[model samples]
Structure formats: structure tokens, C-alpha cells
Target: MENKNIEVKDENGNDDLYEHFRFLADKGQQPLRVDKYLMNRVENATRNKIQKAAKDGNIHINDVAVKSSYKVKPHDVITVLFEHPPYELLLTPENLPIDIVYEDDDVLVVNKEPGMVVHPGHGNYSGTLINALAYHFENLPNPAIINGVNNTNRPGLVHRIDKDTSGLLVVAKTDIAMTHLAKQFFNKTTEREYVALVWGAMEETEGTIEGHIGRHPKNRLQNTVYLNEDDLHKGKPAVTHYKILEKLGYVTLVSCRLETGRTHQIRVHMKHIGHTLFNDARYGGDAILKGTTFTKYKQFVDNCFKILPRQALHARTLGFIHPTTNEFMKFESPIPKDIQQCIEKWQKYSTHAEQ
Candidate 1:
């Protein structure tokens, strides 16, 4: 059997648990029901899981949605998508406080704080937004049921943000709401703008960063942009439009709009152009990349790091069509206190240095 494994990054551009799989039947294969075929071929897969996937329109044959009973002929192409990792974790609700921006029967908007994991994953199995959501929305809608099987592990979560990135996120309260919001995100109809403080002043006041983003071949924990045309297909297209809002002496605060939400799009693109986000530990912005070689300046930089220990990124604005009412909705979040203080400290330091 011909097989291919693909890593499907979460649409929110941070989570890395979702996975997609594709298979091509061997030329000598006999006709078989698609769900039955998948159960036999996919390790740890059950008929109920396959049926649910088919019911949710997640199972496709030759790029078209198919039913569980659809016959898979020789050389037929098959594919399936999982919202979370294959390894199931016992989801337990915790009484964690979340900043609820707006809530309705169909959807809710949250102002996710810095250092909060959006969902439970590899190293984080608790104290996540999912756990908090589970606590709050205990009876949230479940996925499609087929043969008495339903995956209710992740309820109400439609998108996510990075743990260190503070921002606005929307959650769906029902399956229909989830599907509607998911389609909007997939079609790139949602509008998201982030405010970031980068290590250096930008040469241009406004510009667009265009590149294909993919996993770093050497470092599994990092993502890089592919500049070579031949290697473009190895990654996915990503675009970030940025405008400098303020140019501090050592760092610049900028507004970024995302056209395509590839993983780490803003962070990687800005780093590629030599303006990594301030205090972004993973992209090497935690160090003093730009500044004078003065003891006072070094001390000032250290103080700023203490003020905002994580990457200086905030999802300031989000816009999308309402899942239930079909009306366009938009939400804005102010920069967190830590980042605000960091900016104030830099402003004070810059003024002192000029004097």
C-alpha cells in the first residue's frame, strides 16, 4: 500500500497536535468498503472512529467526501484528518479562570493571557484552555456520532494561540458553530492583527513578508521559511503585512496582519528579516541583539526582559462572521500589562540615553 504522513498544523498557527494521513490503495487491491479498509490498514483505528470521520466529512476518497459504505477500488486515494493527536488523554476539567470577552449560546470570545497553553499537548497535559473550557462548558456539543462512537475530548475549541502570545480567540459552543468557524478559518476569511515589539527598528515603515513556512529540517522545535523556489512545496505559503507603529531606539513596535496563518508565520518572518520579537526565547530574541555596548544599556535591557519575560506579541484584533447569526463580528484586546510596562521602560530608557 502507498502511504503518506502529513503534519497538519492548527489553523491558529500555534498548536502542533493535529495530524493528517493519506493512503493510496495498491494496484492489486480488491474493492472494499472505505471504512472497513481504513480499519484494517490504520493501526489503532476502529470502525466506529472511521465511521465518525466519514460522517464528519473528514474522510475523503480522491479528494471527494465519501460515506463509510463507499467502495474503495484499486488505486483509490484515501485521506483522513484528526483534530487532535492520536494519543488520547483523559480530559479533566479544572477551575481555571479565563478572560471571557464575549459569550453567547453559539460562540464565545476569550482574551487568552500570556503563558497559558491553548490545549493539552506533548509536554502539557493539564492547566490548559481546553481544561478550562471543559470545566465551563461541560455539556458542549460532541462530534458526529457513528456506531455509538463520539470524540468529545476537545469541546468548544475551534482555534488556538501560542502559550506566550496573549490574544483574542473564539470558541464554538456547538458542532455546527465549530464547523462554520472552522470553514471561515480554512478559507482565510477571518481577520487577525497582532502587535509585536521586535528587537530592532524596521528600515521600512510598512511592508509585507512573504515566504513558505515549514518545520526546520534540523530543529524539530522550530519553524523556518523556505526561500528556494524548488523547496517551496516543502512548506506552506505564509504572508504577514506589518506597519511600524513606533520606533524605539533599540526595539520597534509594529502591527502585523496575517493573510495566511501558517505556523509561526509572524515570528519566523520577522526573524528572517532581522527583527526578531523582543524576548522571544525560541527565536533568539531573548538576548540583546541590538544596543550600545554600555553597562547602563545592558542593565536597562535586563530590566525590560524582567518586565516582559515572554515574546512581546499580542493578538490585538480579530474579526470573523458570526457562526450563528452570520453577522460580521470583531473584537479587540489591549496589550497585556507586562508588555505595556516593557514599552514604557524602553521609552524612559531611550529618552534618558538621548539626554
Candidate 2:
């Protein structure tokens, strides 16, 4: 990786620029709506700027300034001129040890530990899987498909796991593998299983939750499903099937499978069914772990107002077809130490009632 210094001006003030843009158009095609096209291109750019740039003739479609609504064709040279923002600290490869469960020329699987973020974002900029992968593979493939013109720093990442949720993740080492794996994910052909520790024993041994998930209307940062049918935002359809594995008094250990992957799908669905994961403060598990000794020693617990630092969810098993080899592969990760300890502690304290 290389470092460069640049400057950009935003609403706040003059800031360093650290953004890149790539255009995808073919010759003889009408230009794409500049603002509409750019909305998909730049992740951090403001809509106003993107629109203004197009209106001001700063964007060229096939070397010609066009209206924002101009249609674009393939192979057309689309050029966007914008100020780059300052480079911020992002996930950089480090020598942090990782448990590699499976690896081949096209793909690699690793047992991700809890507390380790899959990628870097707000408030977290280092020690991520991306950083570790960069250090581990000298010539690692860039997994990100440059969609339209978006430029993100993440590379070799096919899927993601939350920072606090530990699990097994597959990384694509080649473009063919990346494409094939992404298709499986998009088509929901891949099989994924998770183990979660939730508060309260399940009344039923097995059940399925189906709902639409979107950002919570009242809470900007949280995701929720609307009870009302007339809400404008139609949440994407998400399904999760769960079976209780064991009961420890009030808490229950369960395994879940996803029919669709949406942001915070499992967590939100579990909470919706009145069984929030143990120690999950967001939905309503805060009271469950109150005064529990498990929080005394864990740094994550100490730092938060709540006990659990991350959601008690783990991606336990993943099975998919090999994109390159055409072979079916399945990978599984055991529960991480922290989650295991939490389960044990709960079992020790809670007197097992009749299951």
C-alpha cells in the first residue's frame, strides 16, 4: 500500500482529499444522469456536490458535457473531476494472528474471533481482517468489484461479520472465485448457520421468523421492522430458522439458519420475537445481564454502559460450491472463548429448570 496527501473542500472547511472515482461507459451511448450516476459512485460525497458538479459541466460523458439525465451507453468515456478528501486511518494489514481454517488458491476460510472487526469503519481504523490479510498474503487479490465508479479501500472481502460477532468467513483469492462466491450470496445458494446465546428459554424448540428489515424510523442508528403496513420503506424480506440446542434456566442456546442476509437480520428478528440475545443492550437485553460477574473482567464490558460488548452471535458453519473447482465445501468454526465463557457462566449461575 502507498500513501499520498491531498486536499478537498467540504461544508466544514478545507480538508485533505482521499477519494477516487472510476467511470463505466461505452462509446455512442447517451450520457448517464450525472448526479444519479454519481450517487452510486461516491460513498462519502454529498448529493449536493455530486449534482452541482454535473450541472456545472464538471463531468464529461464521452468527452462531452451532458445533462444530469443523459443516458449513457457502454464503452463511453465517463470522466468525473472532484477534489479528493484527506486520507483517514483505515484497516491496514498487520501481523495479528488469525486462525486459518481452510485455504486454497481461490479461497481461504478463517475462524474469526469475537471483538475483531471484519473491516474498518467509523471509530475503528486498524487491526481488522483486511489489515491482517494484507500482511499475510503478499499478493492478495482485491475482492471488491469496482461497481460503477465507487472506490472503497476494502479488498479481498466477499462477505462481512459484525465486529463483536465471531464466526467463519470466506475470502476470495481470485477474481473468478470472488464473482462466483458473490453470485451464491446474491442468489442465496450458499448455506450459513449461526449459534447465538439469547436471554430466556425458547417456548418452542424450532421456529422461523419472516419479516422485512430496514432502518428504525424513530432510532436513526438502529434497524427495525415496521408493524404498520403503510410505511414507505419496504424492508427487505429476511428469514431466519432457529432451533434451541440447550436450555440454561432463563437463557437458551440456539442455532439459526438464514434464508436471506440483511443488516442485523438475526439480531433484529430475534429481538422482534421477544428473545433478544443475552447482554444485547440495543433491543432489550440490558436488564438480563445486570450485576452479572461476567462483566467485571472483560474489557469490552467495562467500556460499555451495558455488559456485552458485542452481540452474542457467531457464524458457525458455511457451505458453498467452489467457484473455480466446482466442488462443494463446508466450513465450521467453534464458539470463541469469550462467548463460550459467557455461556458457561450463565449455566453455572442459573439453576436449570425443566426443559
Candidate 3:
């Protein structure tokens, strides 16, 4: 795998240096210290250069020359004059195996396996889906067009699934396809379905959950729904529909659909309904499925958990319109092996209980 050359152009056509200064000033309510702000905005730019630039009267605040300590206000415009640095893609491509469920010139649908990350990020710079795609599509035009402030590794990813959740994902190969797929997702025209083996038998066979989800105030890493109007973390509306496919005594196999995609919508909604997925550590589940009369089956369930590394949730299907042709496209992925084994063990245990 090799690193590719990439060019980052300021789409607004403003001077790069001046635009950077304006972006910092407008991003916050209070004025930013001149030396500190420039250092953060311009990568690898030296403090001496920044100070020199300020002293030379190359920086202006609200059309007037001001010192670095001058406070900024709302709608205030600040500009700085400086040279551009050589921009290059930081991530390199790597050869990794990917399951291609469906493919065409415009788009490709992948049945991603569990444990595979979608893109390279902190501490994970290789063996990602983006890296695999780069190797698979070596001749892709401008394969190195990094989004503004986004890493160069992921150029055509329209949507994402959790790294541990196995399922169908669509990747665009061309700009036209990318634009079309992005629009479908934005309009909520894309359909997504997930199959999960959730703990406890559901009381209701089918239902819909509607709520607003945002970052949890206490646990910054997780999202939680706010029930009050005064909550500072107001979230966007999310809707999820679910139906039980089968019930196996203590566990239920279910299918979920998303009307609005928010982070962890299905998982959170299920937890809200008091039916978290089996083996989901984040939500909570039975630590042990023991003490049952079916001793053999209980052992099987225990073994299943010991072997399975993540929650028993799978992205079963994805449907959307073709980005370039405007034609309907749909893809499905079978449940992964670990989840299937858990379901089988539950079925066996249920039959034993009946006897």
C-alpha cells in the first residue's frame, strides 16, 4: 500500500490564509488570542511567523488593524495573509478482504463482517473498508479528494454502521452516485433494516418508538433521550419500528426499521422499551442464563456468549435508489455465524423446556 497525493482547495475561493483567520474568529463568541488561534488553525505554521505576520499589519479585525489580544464579537470578520503549505493525504491504502454482495459501475454494496472498521481513524490507520476500497479501485479518479477537515482515507462513504455490527453497506464509485446516495439518505428515502436477538421476550409483538436523541450529559460517550424542554442537549427527532420475528422463551428475534437515522437509534429505542440486545454490554443483559432445568441448553447459551465478542445485532438489509440512474436498489445480508448459533441454542433450550 502506498500514500497518494491529494490537493485541498478552498471551495469558497477566498485567500486560504485569510479564510482560516475568519473561520476562527467566527467560530466562537469571544475574541481569540491572535498567537494561539493562528497556531491552531494553520498546521505546522511557526509561532515566529504568526507573530511576524501580526506585527507587519497583515492581520485585520473588522476592517481595522488590532493587536492579538483584541476581543472578537459576533459577525466580526478577521483576515490574515500567509502562504499555503503543501497538502498531502495522510492515510495510505492497504489490502484487506471485503465481502462484495453487489457491485456496478456506479455503486457497490458490501456485506461487512463484524470487527471490521469502516474507515481509518485514531489508532486504526489500516485494515479498514476505505483502505480495502482504495486497493480494489486503484484507478479511481482523484481517489484522494479529502473532505474539508476530514481525513483523506474516506472519500465515498455515504453512511456508516458500527464496527462490531455486521451488515450491508453501499459505497459510491463516482461523484454522481455519491451525490445521489447522499441525497437519498438526507431525505430519509433510504430504507434500513436490522435483525437482532434481544434479551427477554417482548411484551408487544410490534411497535414504534419516537424520541429526540442527543449526547448524554453525564456520559459524554453515549446518547440519551431528553424528556424535558429545558434540557440543554436538544436532539433531533428519531423514529424506529420493530416487530418480533420469533420468540424463544427468554429471548426474542426481532426486525427493526429506521424512519430517521440517529446515532444508536435502534439500540437506544430497544433499551427504552426494556429489551436490550443479548450480550450488549453498554445497555445491560443477563450475566448468566443458568439455573434452568435444561442444564445442557443453559451451558450452550453460556458458551455462545463466551465465544461471541459483540452484541447480537445485524444489519440485515438496505434499500435505496441508484444515485446515477434513479433506479431502486436493495441488498440483504444473512445473519453472521455467531448470532445464528445463539439463536439455534435458544431454540434447542426452548424445546427442552417444553418437554
Q: What does the lDDT come to for candidate 3?
A: 0.70
State which candidate, 1 or 3, has the greater TM-score: 1
Model 2 segments more than 4 A misplaced: 1-83, 86-91, 143-151, 232-234, 289-309, 352-355
Q: lDDT score, residue 224, model 1?
A: 91
Which pairs clash (backbone N, Cα, C closer than 3 Å) in model 3? 31-72
lDDT tens readout by residue for model 2, 2-118: 111222343456553333344654232244565665564444556687678778665666556666776666565556544543232244579999899998898999888878878
TM-score of each: 0.75, 0.70, 0.71
* Local lDDT at 194 for model 1: 98
Better of 2 and 3 by lDDT: 3
> Each candidate: what lDDT?
0.81, 0.69, 0.70
- As for candidate 1, its clashing pairs are none
Task: Report the lDDT tens digits of candidate 3 across residue range 1-355.
Answer: 1122222233355544332234324332445576655555453567787778778665566556667666656456556644442222344677789899988898889999888889765356677888788888854433332222233446667778877788999988887887677778878899999999887778898999888876554454457776575542346678899999998887899999999878778777887777877877765654543235666656766787876768888999999998767788888888888889888888887777779
Off by over 4 Å in 3: 1-89, 139-153, 286-300
What clash count does candidate 1 reach?
A: 0
Q: What lDDT does candidate 3 reach at residue 88?
A: 25
Weakest 10 consecutive residues, lDDT, candidate 3?
A: 1-10
Backbone atom clashes (below 3 Å) for every candidate: 0, 22, 1
On TM-score, the candidate that comes out on top is 1
